[model samples]
Every structure is written in structure tokens, then in C-alpha cells.
Target: NAGVIQTPRHKVTGKGQEATLWCEPISGHSAVFWYRQTIVQGLEFLTYFRNQAPIDDSGMPKERFSAQMPNQSHSTLKIQSTQPQDSAVYLCASSLQGGSNERLFFGHGTKLSVL
Candidate 1:
């Protein structure tokens, strides 16, 4: 089926290390978004891109979060100097470059654990 693909379903990292996650979107979609969800903070919009260009990132935290969509079919989220506060389910969703936010299809998520 054509859907978003996220890897490592789970990740364990040290408090001050780097964590890199991968994603593959549906074949022709051009908009991608990254969202972070946690029991304590609910769902937060991290960032989004359209046609390989970032469209909005007003919800991303200021510390160490970054996202990139190098091509039309894939993207990645990288966390530098991870912290316990950063532990959460990282999700990637995609849709057509403009218009209605298509029914976002999510991956199984990459649950991160910082210790």
C-alpha cells in the first residue's frame, strides 16, 4: 500500500546523544509533517514541508529539534543532545503539496527513550 513508512519502531538513546529517524511518504505526495506526541503535553506540531521546502515550523521547540525533506518522497527528523524531556513518539505524515491536509497517514511511530 502507498503510505508513510517510519523505521526503528523504537529507539533508546543517551541523554546527550543524537538520534536520527527516517521516513518515506506515499509515492507522489509533496507535503510532509513531523509531529511530537507525549502523555504530558499532547500533540505538538513540529514542522512541515511542501515540495522540499519548509512551509511552517511555528510549533517546534527552540532547543534541539530539526526536520528535513530532501526529496519529494522522503524526509527525516534529527534530535541533537537528546534529553528526557524529548522522549516521545515522533510521527511523520504526508499529503499533496497544497489544499486540504489530506487524511494524514501515520507510521507506527518511533518511541524514543532517553536515559
Candidate 2:
């Protein structure tokens, strides 16, 4: 079966521009997680959804970042007023279900570059 799918493999944004990234998890899976990866920060958990509802968003930037799962198969991450500091790889991972014992399958990710 195919793993998670993330669209636009790369994104280029000017300072203050908006960037929208998409993710489509594997069929029949319910847990979706968003993470930001960079050399200095390593991997940072942005948020997650369990059964289409938000589970945790403690890692999201207080102002410019947000995530949503409107349906079963897909999710989106939106960043407003994108800044140079926001330039990083945004990865989306999914599990069969929410809870322990679920293995995460990651998408190729959307590499965002803010100019």
C-alpha cells in the first residue's frame, strides 16, 4: 500500500506570504501528525489528529502556524506571514490509529523556503 502523500514537494514564500501544505494519509488510517525538521532544531512535533480531531498542538508556533484534518484521508498545514525562520521541512506522518503501538509512516514532506 502507498504511504502518506504530501503535495507541492517544495514551496517558496516571500516574507509575509502565506504557504499552505497538504497531506493525504494512507487509507483507513486515523492518526495524523505534523512535524517540522531542521538542522538546528532537529525534529519538532507541530500537532496531531486522532479520528479527525485535534489531539495536541503544543508544538505549534503560537501565532503563524496551524493545522487541520477536515476529513478522514487528508489534512492541511497553513502558515501565515511566513518568515525566513519558518523555512524548514514540514513532514506529515500517519498511523493506523491513535494511541500507543502505532507506527508512523511519513510523507516525503514539503520543503518550504522563505525569502
Candidate 3:
């Protein structure tokens, strides 16, 4: 079975443009997670969902970043008015169980570049 599927492995956008990232979790997984990686912030958990229901989004920036799990198979992360600082590797992970202590399988991640 596939671990996770992330489309448009690499994306480039203008500083003010909007960017959308996609993820397909493994079948049978109950939880999905999103994270951002940058030089300054090694790995920052952005948001997550369990059984297609949003769980936590405290890590997301109130202004331009948002994530949604509309269904079981897929999830989306959107960044509006993109800035250079938004450039980073956006990772998606999923697990059979969700909590502070659970093993998660991650995707290759979508690398976003804001110019």
C-alpha cells in the first residue's frame, strides 16, 4: 500500500500568489497531520485531523495558512498572499491512531518556493 501521496512535489509561486498543497493518506489511517520545515523552524506541526475531522490547528498562522480534511482519502493546505517566508517543505503524515504518542508515516512532502 502507498504510504502517502503528495501532488505537485515542487511548486513555485509569486510572493503575493496563493498556493495549495494536496495529500492522500494511506487507506485505513485514522489521522492526518501537516507540518512545515524551514531552516529556522526545523519542523513545525501545522494542523491535523482524525477520521476526516479537524483536530488541532493552533500551529497555523491565523492570517494566511489553513488546512482541511474534507474526506477520508485526502486533505488540503492553502496559503494565501504567499510570502518568501512561506517557502518550505510541507509534509503530510498519517497514522492508524492519533495522539501525542503515536507513530506516523510521512510523505515525501511538497516543496513550495515563493519568489
Candidate 4:
């Protein structure tokens, strides 16, 4: 299996622009998750899907950010009006079973830089 694949390992955008990060989960995996990594928050869970269904997303910012799993194999994280503060390493993870405590394998992550 290819494991989780996050495209555009690095991205740079101007403030007020939009940024979209993509992820391809492992084959046959039922759960895919999104997270943001930063010095302050460490690994902050953003959202996830189980069996291609949206699950919890309370940790995500109410505005300017959104996550979606359109199919079993892939998911996307979109940020509108990107700001300097939004710059961070966006990570995607997946596991065979879906649960908060389940062991997850993570992608290398997409580093977003805003200027």
C-alpha cells in the first residue's frame, strides 16, 4: 500500500489568497484524519471521516477553513483568505478502523507558508 499521500509537500501563498491541500489515504482504510502542527499546539486534530462520512471537526477554525472527504480514497483541506497565522504543517492520517484512540499512520504533511 502507498500509505497516506499528501501532495505539494510545500506551498507558499500571499495573504488573502486561498490554499488547498490534498490527501490520498491508504487503500481499504475506512478512516482519514486532518491535523495542523505548530510549535504552540503540537498536533491539533482538525477533522476526520469514517467510511467517507464526516465526523468531529470541533478543533477546526469556524471561518476560513474547511475539510472534506469526497470519497474513500481522498480528502482535501481548504483555507480561504489565508493569513500568516495560517501557515503551518498540515498533516493527514489514516487507520484501518475509525476511532479517536485508534493507531493512525500520518503523511509527511504539506507545509504552508503565507506572506
Candidate 5:
């Protein structure tokens, strides 16, 4: 367990609703990951695994944003009261080792549209 897990490959939600994204990291990999992508900011790091723990979620909104790693195989990101500004592709990744220089295996990403 490391960070959020985004699923569905695509998600659409009305404004003020909730969006829960799921991600299942590669088995045997020690690190799980999450990222957000928008045209304005490109790709932004949300969280990552380090020594089996998650660290550095500075990119996530202070409010209406949360991530959890309940187990080693999966993680989740929940957005409460979704907003249009929250629309973006949520990416999940995993690495054999947890480190800044380690290679990552990335999912296609879950596209979330908040209307």
C-alpha cells in the first residue's frame, strides 16, 4: 500500500458529488503512486510510497482531497464534493523499489470529469 488507486479508466460526476478513484499497484512492487494531470499544470505529483509508507501529498487540495492505502495491493483517492476544477486524469503507478530514481509502471489513468 502506498497511495491512491484510480479505476474505471474514466469517471464522470456532477458538481458537488463524490469521486473515488482506485489503483492496484503491480504485485511485488514496493511502491504505489498517484498523480494528477491538467492542461494548466501538466502532470503533478500527488503522493508516492517510501519504505512502505506514503509521503508528500503537497499537490493535493487542502480540502476535499484524501488518499488511503489500506493494503499492499491497492490504494484509493477520494474527492469530496467534486468541482469542475477537479476534473483531470488521475494516474497510478508502481515501482519495484521506492525511490526518486526508480522506474515506474504507469496505468492509462482514470479520467475524471466534474461537471
Candidate 6:
């Protein structure tokens, strides 16, 4: 069975520290995937990938937040100067293809906690 895999099921970082989250999409699936879930904002799209390229990141904060898909097997989300407001369940998902119509396979998520 293959599925998206996110590392560090839980992470704790200090308010000015940095947090790097990893996500390994199913072996064969493609298209960019990253989302953040919080009690106040619910589920929000952070970025989208297609053919290992970032195509959209409008939902991400202009500063301190970035995502990248270096290859077909994995992707990453890094947050700089982490703040308490940055804490959330960072979800990684992939679709059979890149688009809104395709089904998404999501990892359990990496819960980030900032102090």
C-alpha cells in the first residue's frame, strides 16, 4: 500500500526558530500538494505543484513560508521565524493528476507547535 508520508508526526519549535516538514508522496502520484489546518482557519491551500514545479502559493504567507518539490518522490515545507500563530497540522496531499477534479491522497499530517 502506498500513501503520502509526512515526517515528524509532531514538532515543537521556539518562536524565532525554523521548522522544516517533509512529505513523501505515493511513489507514482504527481502534482504539487501542501495544506495547513488550524482551528481558526480550517483547511487552507498553501501551494500546488505540477511536474515538480511550484505553480501556486497564493495562500501562503508572503514571508517566512515556502514549499518546494525537488522531484517526483518528495516535497517540503519550511517555515522561518516560527511564531505561535504558525502552529497547525501541516497536511501533504497528492492527486493522480494536477487539478481540482482529481482525488487527493493525504498523509496523517505533521502537527507543528510553536512556543
Q: lDDT per model, in order?
A: 0.86, 0.95, 0.94, 0.93, 0.84, 0.91
- Please, what are the lDDT tens digits per residue for candidate 5 over residues 1-115? 4433457889999999999998888778878778899999999998876545777778778899998888888888999999999999999888887777888888889999998
lDDT by residue (tens digit), candidate 3, 44-113: 9999899988888989999999899988999999999999999999999999879678899999999999
Candidate 4 clashing pairs, residues 3+ apart or interchain:
none
The top-ranked prediction according to lDDT is: 2
Model 2 clash pairs are none
Q: In model 5, how large is the Cα lDDT of residue 25?
A: 83
Per-candidate TM-scores read 0.93, 0.97, 0.96, 0.96, 0.89, 0.96
Candidate 6 lands at a TM-score of 0.96
Q: Give lDDT tens digits, candidate 4, residues 1-115.
A: 7779999899999999999999999898899989999999899989988998888898899999999888888999999999999989999999997865778989999999999
- Which digits, one per residue and each the tens of the lDDT, describe model 6 over residues 1-115? 6688999999999999999999998877878589999999999999988889888899999999988888898899999999999999999998877867888989999999999
lDDT of 1 by residue, 1-115 (tens): 7578998899999999999999998778888888898998888889988889999988887678888888887898989999998899998888766457367777777899999
Model 3 ranges with Cα > 4 A deviation: none
In model 3, what is the error at residue 16, expressed in angstroms? 0.8
Total backbone collisions, model 3: 0
Model 3 accuracy (lDDT, Cα):
0.94
Say which prediction, candidate 4 or candidate 5, comes out ahead on TM-score.
4
lDDT assessment of candidate 1:
0.86
User: What order do candidates take by lDDT, descending?
Assistant: 2, 3, 4, 6, 1, 5
Against the true structure, what is every candidate's RMSD? Answer: 1.2, 0.7, 0.9, 1.0, 3.3, 0.9
Instruction: Tell me model 4's lDDT, rounded to 2 decimals.
Output: 0.93
Candidate 5, residue 48: CA error in Å?
1.6
Give me the candidate number with maximum TM-score: 2
